[model samples]
Target: MFPKSLFPIALLSIISLGSVSAVDYSETYVGCVPIGTGTSGALYSPSVYIIEDCNFACADAGYTYAYFSNPASSFCSCKNTGPAPGDISSVASGNTNCGSFQATVNALATDYSFQSCYNSPASDDTTSQSTFDSCFERCSTYTNALVAPAGTTYTCLCSNTTPSGTAESCGYDGTFFAYSHTAISSPSLVDRRRRRLERMKRDEQLRLNRFCPGGLQACIVPGSDDSFECIDTSSELESCGGCLYGSYTNSTAPAGVDCSILRGAAFGGATCANGRCEISACREGFQLVDGKCQ
Candidate 1:
């Protein structure tokens, strides 16, 4: 658990597309504050260092913020509300540690070039006549970014469905350009892996629906998160064979009564037979007949 920090957004530095730095992301830098210094950051922690993935993940989750731990920052959450009085402190490394990641991402800068295409959309960052570096940097946030200098109707266009045209020479004048992001694995692959794990968990639970002790059965109590409990109804005093309030298991659930709670049978000596209640003794001044106290 990291110490929870609640500094105002004003204290952070939100980098724009024009900023000449190694790091490029939507969220601002909050210094080199370590994870132990703060509490858990967010629910989405990437196993690998794909800054874009972290940003897209936080944004998709409807969060306004995403943070990184530099070389290996696995924190991304929207918990930054505001700092307490006199709680604003710096981590000493401001954008200095950012270069390590930037250097790795910047290698692709030379690989990207403007292509030739039509129906070009407007620039995502709103600036035009973008050089290769600026265009690539500005379009980093987009999944399928297509950009070129002015005069393509729209300065920049991002379309995941549209296949990029043949790679064309990059220039300031109007010409279509596309980025493949071949440097890293597809972002959707990460989501697929997570979904696969969840499916496996569900499948495992379903498999266990019929597995339990010889006479015991799995039962899901009401209000439980789909979790089931193993119970034996044949001899349980409170529940002879199953739950009393309700049963929500995937298989046919057994319903039984509380053997010790029988009113017709002896209050203190009632016993369960298979799934029925038996009166072994009667209350004081009462005689047992026809399986009831008379």
Candidate 2:
């Protein structure tokens, strides 16, 4: 069960999940534009083979615009803004269109309000408005404003794209919001963040495994498929090898002792290794036999 106040927020998140859609290339102007030939900008790598690849690269790098030239060669370049109208060459059959990348909306709950609108390098402000509805109206004015977040009072912050470290919270005591211009409601920005979180989770799990290789006490079984457990196994006598002692039973005994000698030694000089008990030496006055002390 969840608190009634949280239901709306949960519902909004669920609704937002369904809104994600593919990128739209038509919003941009497509033409053959050579990099460094017409404008002064930094050249990227050959890894950007496709238009989407270039767009994502530019977005991740915090560039407002990206251009892919020589599709076959995958030459790409990023810039703070697209090339000038005069610099654009005739539209080529294979060249990608120059357009702003779509941004995802991120909501941040805050305890203070924004003193002023903080726009990114390529952001457009909708001025101060009284309501969220009025702020959304300004989104229509900026052709590239894909992400718009209503700020304190009537201010609206809009941007053409979002970067990896884009601020989630703007002002003190102010709630941040965002919207997309594309039909697909889900934004790539959110997707990127989600992927990053998943990677972090995987890395954390790997770290845990490295620290506790044999599995932590009773919480995990050393060699079992389902090894993870929540119960504390550190002091468990039965699971000395990180699993139930009975699980290691052999023809010689119903239960095997762990590596420690604290458990009474029923068998002569018995030692546990890899979940199995072996007799390397016998008790005093005992003579060694075929497999045990006689």
Candidate 2 residue-pair clash tally: 11
The Cα local distance difference test for each model comes to: 0.42, 0.38
Q: What does candidate 1's lDDT look like per residue over 42-136, in tens digits? A: 33333324555554443333333345444544444332221111221223332124332221111111233323333344443444523333444
Off-target runs (Cα >4 Å) in candidate 1 are: 1-211, 222-227, 250-254
lDDT of 2 by residue, 1-294 (tens): 122232222322212324333322211322334444322344333254455555544443333445565433445555434433234332222222322322111111111112212234245564665543344445543433322223334345555554223443322123233344432244674455445435533533443333233544223345553333432244444444444532221112233345345333345366555555555666666665664556
Against the correct fold, how does model 1 do in TM-score? Answer: 0.26
Going through the candidates in order, what is the number of backbone clashes in each?
15, 11
The top-ranked prediction according to TM-score is 1
The candidate scoring highest on lDDT is 1
Model 2 CA RMSD to the hidden true structure, in angstroms = 20.3
